[model samples]
Target: MENDCSRFVQKCHKCQIHGDLIKVPPTEPNAMMSPWPFAAWGMYFIGPIEPDASNKHCFILVTKDYFTKWVEVASYSSVTKKVVTDFVRNNIICQFGIPESIITDNGANLNSHLMKEMCAQFQITHQNSTAY
Candidate 1:
C-alpha cells in the first residue's frame, strides 16, 4: 500500500518542480458577465432557520428599503416552493407592488424552479449571493 501511494504521488509530479508543494492558479471570472452599477432600491432577503423538534424547517423573508432603511419580515414553516411562492406573491409583492429586485441567500428553496417561475410571473428580478 505504501509503495502504491508513493508511485501515485510521483505520477502527480513533473520535471522542474521548484517548491515543496504544488500550487494551483485561481479560477477566472465569467467572461459573459459585465460590471453592474449599484442602484438604491428595496430588496428582499430570504433564508431558512434551524430545524425544529419535528424536523420541520422555518423560513424568514426580510425586506429592506435601501434609501430609508425600512425593514419587514415574514416567517413560514415548510419553506417549500409553493409556500415561499405564495408568501412572496401575496405578502411582499401584493403589499408593495414590485421592487427593482430581490436579493436572497443561496438556499436550495430560494433556487428552485417554482421560485424562478414565480419571479418570472411577477416580473421581479432575483439575485442570489455567492458563497463566501
Candidate 2:
C-alpha cells in the first residue's frame, strides 16, 4: 500500500507543480562565513500583507548581518526599486557602513538597474539566489 501510494504521488503532475519548492542544493550547501560583524548581509521582502492603521504599511523589508545576526526591518506601503535602494542606502550603508556583500532573492525590486548602479557605486557585491 505504501509503495503504491508513493508511486501514484511521484507520477502526479499537479502534485509536482504545486509542491513545495526546494531552496537548497541537492548536495550539502557550502557554509558562508563572515569575516567580521556587518561584513555580509542578507535581505528579504515580506508582504503585501494586511495593511495597518498607523501608516498603511503593507510591505516589510528585512535585513540581517551574517556574522552578528543583527536584524533591521522597515515598513513600506509599496515596494519599488527606489524604495529598496533607499533602504539599503540609509539604513544599511549609512547606519552600519558599507557591507562586503549582500545576498538577496532575484526579485525585480532587488535586481533592478538602479540597484545594480547603487551597488557598483558603493563597490558592494550583490549576489542573487536561485529561485525556489
Candidate 3:
C-alpha cells in the first residue's frame, strides 16, 4: 500500500537522505500586538532569489509595523549590518520617527554590533524572536 511504502522510506536512511527535496516554503508567523502604530516593528530578510534583477539584487529586506500592519521593503544584492542599520535609520526612523521597540530573528546581521549600537543610541528596545 502507499502508506506502507512511505513508512518503509522513512525508516531507510538512504531513502530519506536521497529523497526529493521539499520545495514548499514554511508557514509565516503573523504580527503580534503592538501598543501603537509605528511604535514597534518586525524585520526579516528573504533570499538569494533566482534570476537576479537588472540591478543584480537577489535579496529582499522587509519590515512590518506591528500596529498598523504597514510594510516597508527593499531589494539588495547583499545585506550587512550597515545596510540594516541604514534601513532602520532612513526607512524606519526618518520616515516614521523613532520606534519604541523593534523585533528581529537572531540573525547575525540583524543582531550585529552595528545594529545594537544604533538601537542603543536611539534608545529603541531590541527583541529577538524564537522559532515556534
Candidate 4:
C-alpha cells in the first residue's frame, strides 16, 4: 500500500508541480580562520561618500584583520591601483607588519597588475572573493 501511494504521488503531475520544494545548498559552507592578529585581512572600498572636512576625500578604503577584528581605514579622492597598493603598504603593512594574506572583492583596482605586483613584492598572498 505504501509503495502504491508513493508511485501514485510520483505519477501525479499536480503533486510534482505543487509539492513542497526541497532546499538544497549548492556548496558546503566553509569558515575562515586566522591564526593571529593581522595574519589575514579583508579589504574593500566604500563610497563616493559626501566629502568631509578633507575636501579631497571621496572614497574610503577599509581593511579589517580577520582574527582580531581590527579595522584600518583611509580616505581618498579617487581609488586607483596605486592608491590601494599604497594604502596596504603604508597603513596595514607599516602599522601592523606584513599580513600573510589579504582578501578583496573582484574589483579591477584590487586585482590590477600593479596591485598584484605590490603584493608579490611584499610576499603577501592576495585572494578574491567568489561571486554569488
lDDT winner: 3
lDDT of each: 0.61, 0.92, 0.94, 0.89
lDDT (Cα, tens digit) per residue for candidate 4, span 61-87:
999999999999888888899999888
Q: Give the per-residue lDDT of model 2 (tens digit) for 44-75.
A: 89998874648899899999999999999999
Q: Rank the candidates by TM-score, best first.
A: 3, 2, 4, 1
How do all models score by TM-score?
0.52, 0.74, 0.75, 0.72
Residue pairs in candidate 3 whose N, alpha carbon or C atoms collide under 3 angstroms? none
Candidates sorted on lDDT, descending: 3, 2, 4, 1
- All-Cα superposition RMSD per candidate: 9.8, 7.2, 8.6, 6.2
Write down the worst ten-residue block by lDDT for model 4. Answer: 49-58
Q: Give the poorly placed runs of model 3, Cα more than 4 Å off.
A: 1-32
Error of 1 at 111 (Å): 1.4
Structure candidate 1, residue pairs in collision: none
- The lDDT of model 4 is 0.89
The segments of candidate 1 whose C-alpha lies over 4 angstroms from its true place after superposition are 1-59
lDDT of 3: 0.94
